[model samples]
Target: MLRRWREEDKEPFAVLNADPVVMEHFPATLSREESDALAERVEVAFDERGFGLWAVEADGEFIGFTGLSVPRFTAHFTPCVEIGWRLARSAWGRGYATEAARASLEDGFGRVGLTEVVSFTAVPNVRSQAVMRRLGMTHDPAEDFDHPVLSQGHSLRRHVLYRIRRRK
Candidate 1:
């Protein structure tokens, strides 16, 4: 289930962020302080935009998070809502990301009234690309770009962008 963040979720979320496997696609694993700060930012985003990453719970336990947020950098896709997810390794392969992402898309299009949502990850992060595909998001190689947040020579700088539009 996707829901609001809880204070108890911070520890597990930090653990999830610190997992090397989980952080492989990005620059590096987040330290506990960084992870906690991210959680705080997510909470603030929801308060400001009325939509942000929702904490994912399974069997009544906080597993991770999935939801929508506006990308912060400048790009052709900037100013767009993006669907994203991150879960504990134990929670992997459970279809929770897809399920929660579908609900997020519903909220984005139905409630938030967004026309499109986009998701992106490093070129090597096929796992997330697969999730995007499973959600029926389309990718065009021509749309790929270097992630602005990553330094020019960073290995994960190049990323693939996927997009899905709300059906009329």
Candidate 2:
């Protein structure tokens, strides 16, 4: 299920952020303090924008998060809303991320009225790329690029971009 983050979500989210497997694609794992700050930012984004990455619940527990957010860096796809997620190791192998992301896309295209949602990941992140494809998003090899935020030659700098347009 998809909903806004509560104060209760902070601790588990912090631990999720610190997991090496979960943080492998990003620059580094966040400290607990950093993760809490990120949760604060997500809450603020929802308040300011009326929507952001939603806290996910399954089996009555806060497993992880999935939803839409604006990418903070400049890319060929600047000004796009992107669908993404991060789940705890315990939550992997379930359909949760795909399911939550579908709800998020519905909210984006239905209630939020966005026309297109983009998702991207480091080139080697086949796991996330697979989720993106499962969301019915399509990629263009021509659209791949080095992430501007990563230093030159960083291992994960190269990224694949996928996009799904709102249905008529």
Candidate 3:
């Protein structure tokens, strides 16, 4: 089940970030302080917006997080909302990311009334790309960008954008 993040979730989330395999696509593993701060921000967003990165659980285990976030970083396409997800190494290949992310998209387009949603990943992150495709998102290569927050030459700088519009 998916639910809002809680303070108690920080430890498990930190563990998720600590996994080398899970952090491989990311630039670096998040420090415990960073993970706690992130969880606090997610909780605040949920309080203000009614939705944010949700704690994904199955039979009372913390799988990871999945939800919608307003992209704050500058991009070729700025000021867009995005649906995203991340899972622990143990959760990889289990369809949990896809399942939880689909629910996030549904809530974004259906409940939150967003007309469209976008997602992006580093150019080499095929796992995320596959999940985006499974969610019916279409690539817009023209919108691909070098992530502004990363150094210009960073290995994870280039990203591919994917988008999906809600059906009328």
Candidate 4:
């Protein structure tokens, strides 16, 4: 289930974020404090936007998060809603990312009334790109961009973009 974060979720969420495998596509694993800060930000986004990356649970325990967010950094696709997810290694291969992401897109196009939603990942993150495709997002290589948040020479700076439009 993708639900709002609770105080008790801090530790589990931090454990998910601290996993090196889970953080591999990005720069680095988040420290405990950093993970907590991220949870706070996620909650604030929900308060401000009506929806954000919600905590995920399985077997009635925190696993990770999956939902919609507005990219803070500028790109050619600035001002777009994006669907994303991250699950603990143990929770992977269980269809959690795809299931939760499908729900996120439903909320994006339905409740949020967004015309379109986007998703992206580093060049090597075929796993996430696969999820984006599974969510019906199409990629146009021309739309790809160097992530603004990454350092100029960073290997992961070049990222691919995928977008899906709300069905008529």
Candidate 5:
């Protein structure tokens, strides 16, 4: 299940952030301070907007996070609401990302009233791309972009954008 993040979740969340494999697609692993700040911002976004990255748990154990957030980075496609999730390395190979992301997409279209929800990952992140496909998202290769946050030569600099629109 998914719920708002709490202060107690920091340690587990930090562990998820610290894993080298888990942080592979990301530019770098987040520092403790950065993780805490991110959690705080997620919390504040939930409070202010009624939605943000939610702590995902199963049978009372922390799993990871999944939710909707507006992509703020300047990109080939900017100012789009995106559905996203990240799980621990132990949680890999499971359907958790797809499950949680499907729910987030439902919330985006049904409750949040978004016409379309987009998701993106580094071109090399086949695992995440597979999950996007399983979620019924279609990729627009023409929209692929070099991530602005990373340097030109960064391995994860190029990313592909996928989107699924709410059916009428």
Candidate 6:
């Protein structure tokens, strides 16, 4: 189930962020303080934008988050809402990300009135790319870009972009 973030989610979320395996595709794992700060930002996003990453729970446990957000960094896709997810390692392969993301897309295209949504990740993140494909998002190599937040020549700088539009 997807719901607003709660104070109790902090502990589990920190653990999820700290897990090296869970953060394998990214640059590095987040510290507890960093995790909490991110959660706070998510809350602010919801208040400011009316939509942000929703905490995902399974059988009453905080698994992760999936929803839409505006990318902080400038890219060709800047100023666009993006559907994203990050589940705990244990929650992988459970279809939670895909299910929650579908709901996010629905909300984006429905109530939020977004005509399009994009998803991107490091080129090495085939797992997330697969999820994008499962959601019917299409990719064009020409749209791929170097993540502006990363330093030049950084291993994770290269990223692939995928997009899906609201059905008429």
As for lDDT, the candidate ahead, 4 or 5, is 4
- By TM-score, how accurate is candidate 2? 0.98
What tens digits encode model 3's per-residue C-alpha lDDT throughout 1-168?
Answer: 898776677899999988878888789999999988888888888888877888999778888899998887876676888888988787889899899999999899888999989999999999999999999999978889988889878999999999999998
Please report the TM-score between candidate 4 and the true structure: 0.97
Q: How does model 5 score by TM-score?
A: 0.96
The models' CA-based lDDT, in order, is 0.94, 0.94, 0.88, 0.91, 0.88, 0.95
Residue ranges of candidate 1 with Cα displaced over 4 Å: none
**lDDT measured at residue 115 in model 5 versus the true structure, 0 to 100:** 93
**RMSD of candidate 5 to true structure, Å:** 1.0
Candidate 5 regions with alpha-carbon error over 4 angstroms: none
Task: Estimate candidate 1's alpha-carbon lDDT, on a 0 to 1 scale.
Answer: 0.94
Compared with the true structure, what per-residue lDDT tens digits does model 1 show for residues 9-92? 999999999999988898999999999999999999999999999999999999999999888899977888899999999999
Q: What clash count goes with each model?
A: 0, 0, 0, 0, 0, 0
Quote each prediction's TM-score.
Answer: 0.98, 0.98, 0.96, 0.97, 0.96, 0.98
User: lDDT for model 3, on a 0 to 1 scale?
Assistant: 0.88
Best by lDDT: 6
Across 60-89, the per-residue lDDT of candidate 6 in tens digits comes to: 899999999999889877889999999999
Per-residue lDDT over 1-168 for candidate 5, one digit per residue giving the tens place of the 0 to 100 score:
988887888988898998888999998999888888989999988888877888998768788899998887987667888888989887878788888988888888888888988899999899999999999999978999998888989999999999899999
Per-residue lDDT over 1-168 for candidate 2, one digit per residue giving the tens place of the 0 to 100 score: 888899999999999999999999999999999999999999998998888999999988999999999999998899899899999989998999999999999999999999999999999999999999899999999999899999998999999999999999
